[model samples]
Target: MLSDLPIRKIIHVDMDAFYASVAQLDNPELKGKAIAVGGCETRGVISAASYEARKFGVKSAMSGNLAIKLCPELIFVKTNFERYKEISKRIRKIFLDYTDLVEPLSLDEAYLDVTKNKKGNPSASLIAQEIRERIFNEVGLTASAGISINKFIAKVASDYNKPNGQKTVNPEEVLSFLEHLDIRKFYGVGKVTAEKMYQKGIFTGLDLKSKSLDFLETHFGKSGRYYYHVVRGIHTSEVKPNRIRKSLAAERTFSENLSSEVFMLEKLNHIAEEVSKRLSKSKVAGKTITLKIKYSDFSLQTRSKTLPYYINDKDLIFKTAQDLLYQEQLNNSVRLLGISLSNLNTETKKTPEKESVSVQLKFGF
Candidate 1:
């Protein structure tokens, strides 16, 4: 499959600790501090913790209260998704200038197919370097990039050098790199799956490649084909444009702490307007509305309501958030407000057969 596909240069650019890093960028004072962005309350969880917080054992999805206890000096900041998205758009513009083959994994990362280039740069590695430099120079932020013949290796290469660095894996070096890599680092190999593979003596990519396709298929069921292909670095992932508007979400961080219901509701209105504009721009409608609030204590809460029919109008989103706001009994002062619309029903044909296959969640959130 890979041989039939384009022999292109693929680059994976991933931002390190994206949310926390964005916070640091906006507020220079947060630099070098152990920072957490998410819910601050005992019941809330950390969305993104800086490396400093990670050093103190704080991590994403971990309970906020536990994170604070582990590192009492942890500084909590609410998420500002709107600002992040704006910055993401500017970065994406840079990618499109290089090539139209830009597939966004999220606001923080993307895969670029630059086999045929606009710049006519001799090497993909050099292109990646330029892209990283451009992001830093224009956005005042650092990004790590990976370069390789295929997507899988390129994704891995990006992580080889973390936090403002780049790595490349040429065709000759691929096998040796896989040989020394721990099984956990292999794409799609999670803890449970790695343990199972270990039990089967599949400890490395070389070992994994050695297994019979039938044996892998019989043991792993449908995922065997994927295992067989990935071990040999046969990645069929494509870099396609992400223009669909399945959902639009916006959030903001307060300059100061806030606990008032009136103040928080007002912030929700602004975010609702942003979401509404995005939905209108995409010419889409949504069936579900969600409200996200983060308190000064770092507690986060979300309330969602699905309508009987689809709607994308701003007033409707605002009203939905207002209802969810009233439900919050003022347990904490909200430091951030977010509005999201989901269950989008765009004006398009039924999902194409090719697109119907559920892509594995090995990467891209």
Candidate 2:
């Protein structure tokens, strides 16, 4: 039986080493140099590592001391989030130029559904290439893009070529391509899941496909069906442009470890203020307030309290975070403190223009 198949054109764009790349682009001398963006070389963590520093195993969230040990010549640069956000805004505008179905995963990555685009173009691959070129020329930053039948394939394909590149997987080729891929490379398969899959004798997509749906379900639980469909090139997840922000957070790593409650309270106040500013900027309020603390020895802990109602006030933010902080007994000197608000209210009334162009995603191949 020949049934009409719903074909989609999805594109996933990921900026390569975004923070480090921006740092290098803004500073001429930083080009071709090993640089890590974040705090001082003596304290805190690396937020991003340039390609040069990455060669020596320096990565984001690694301790400054270890990063320096890995790459002795690594230069640490302070993160300029304001500048990065501005560049991200410009990049987002470019995506909106093609389709309104743009789902930003982060400041540097997004998924775009261009099945029926504003450009009146049917070629998703060409659009991906054009977007990458425009980002490099207009934003002075390199972007990698992947075009495929669905979001899962596109996101995986984007990482196939690092730095600056694009890959397109046509609908007809989706099944064959997935079969050759490693099991670990599947979208939601993490280290623990991959290890479990390996123990089950499922080492690759081909291996996974060999098992019966019932067998997979019997072993892997609810996720079993997810693997069954995905291995057969089936995923229905859409690029949700109207997805609400679940959380707003801001945190800082101090140059010196704080031991006293006074110092912690002051830092929490600053962090709470930053979170409030972000919430206000987004015009969103959240009910849950979380306080994250990283000790000098690299251990991390978090304390959270959910309120009865949403709040965006700085005073309330500080007070909530302060209360959480004081409730916990000091076990060690804290190297970093952070404040975040989750359970956010990001609902927005849809405009007629948005309603007219909203995408309807299709499932399966």
Candidate 3:
């Protein structure tokens, strides 16, 4: 029955502690030391942590103060987005040598469909290894990879190994592998969802499989159907090469919270200008404008207005954001403000699905 399903060779390549590793690579003094890519001792959040930092419970999205409490020796480095983008371009060049069917998830990772690669290699495992090696040798960075019959499995498998390793889940091993997988390891399942699943006695993929479709749907809503299929080795998401940009945004976290909307106009104008620059760079415009406000207490609020037509001008964006700012009274002192444009003009027409073909379980590696 598994052999009857369509199969595609997919590889998910993830750079190992990308931001932190890049810092180490550029500065010899940071090598093998506990380091974070962003944040500071008093304010902000850690963007990425090194393996050394991870050993001490330091992690991304953690408050800098908390991270310091976890690892007192943690070294915080400034983020260099331009440098990261430069390295990412080099890595992407290597991927293109293997296949044009590359879908980049971020500057640090991407999904590549190598079923019919330019290398003429039937072994997806070998392709993944070569890609990782190339990334290390050419970009001065280590990467990990997961190779499987589908994107979902490939993404999950990629994390099984870390720093500089690879894992391949052959078509035949998909069921056994997923069955034993921890419920929390499912890519889309977050802490909240996992806890909910645990309450329902679904701790592993096998347990999840035991629940009837109706039972799962009754409990999990739309996600229930997704969980039902993935465990059975049945994910059909294609690797889309040119993923569209959904939104453009710019935001700032103030060092001091402002109590009045009058003081936010300058900040809003600057943010709008930044958003406009990004929109122009992406060559896209949007109909929806959103204002995001984060209070001093960390509470968040959003106000949105969908225009009659798309816009990308700074003045227009600032005016919309200005209108939104006064639309509601101040809930609390605002610490952060952002402007985003969505419902983009770049939205693509849906393409017809390609015909699925039967694939035999013959992994060359």
Model 2: CA > 4 A from native: 1-5, 211-225, 347-365
Better of 1 and 2 by TM-score: 2
TM-score of 3: 0.95
Q: Better model by lDDT, 2 or 3? A: 3
lDDT of each: 0.80, 0.86, 0.91
In the range 209-290, model 3's lDDT, one tens digit per residue, is 8999999899999999999999998898888887878888989877678987778999999999999999999889999999
Query: How does each model score on TM-score?
Result: 0.71, 0.88, 0.95
Residue pairs that clash (backbone atoms under 3 angstroms), model 2: none
Lowest summed lDDT across 10 adjacent residues in model 1 is found at 356-365
Q: Tens digits of per-residue lDDT for model 1 on 1-365? A: 43344345789999888999999989999999999998674546688999889999999978777999999999989879799999999999999888877889889999988776698775788888899899889998889998876778888888888988998877556667777777778877888989999999988888888899999999888988888887776776666665455677888767666767778777888888888898888788888898887777767788899999888788888998899888758667776788888888863535332221222222111
Clashing pairs in 1: 39-298, 39-299, 39-300, 40-297, 40-298, 40-299, 41-298, 41-299, 259-333
lDDT tens digits by residue: candidate 2, 1-365: 00133457889999999999999899989999999999557787888999999999999889898999989999999889899999999999999999989999999999998888899887888888899999999989999988887788999889888879988877667788888999988989998999999999999899999999998899988999999988877776777887777788998888888999998888888888889998988999999999999888888899999999989999999999889988869779998899999888764444233332223343221
Error of 2 at 254 (Å): 2.0
For model 3, what is the error of residue 47's alpha carbon versus the real structure, in angstroms, after optimal superposition?
A: 1.4
Per-candidate clashes come to 9, 0, 0
List candidate 1 stretches off by more than 4 Å: 1-5, 243-282, 285-365
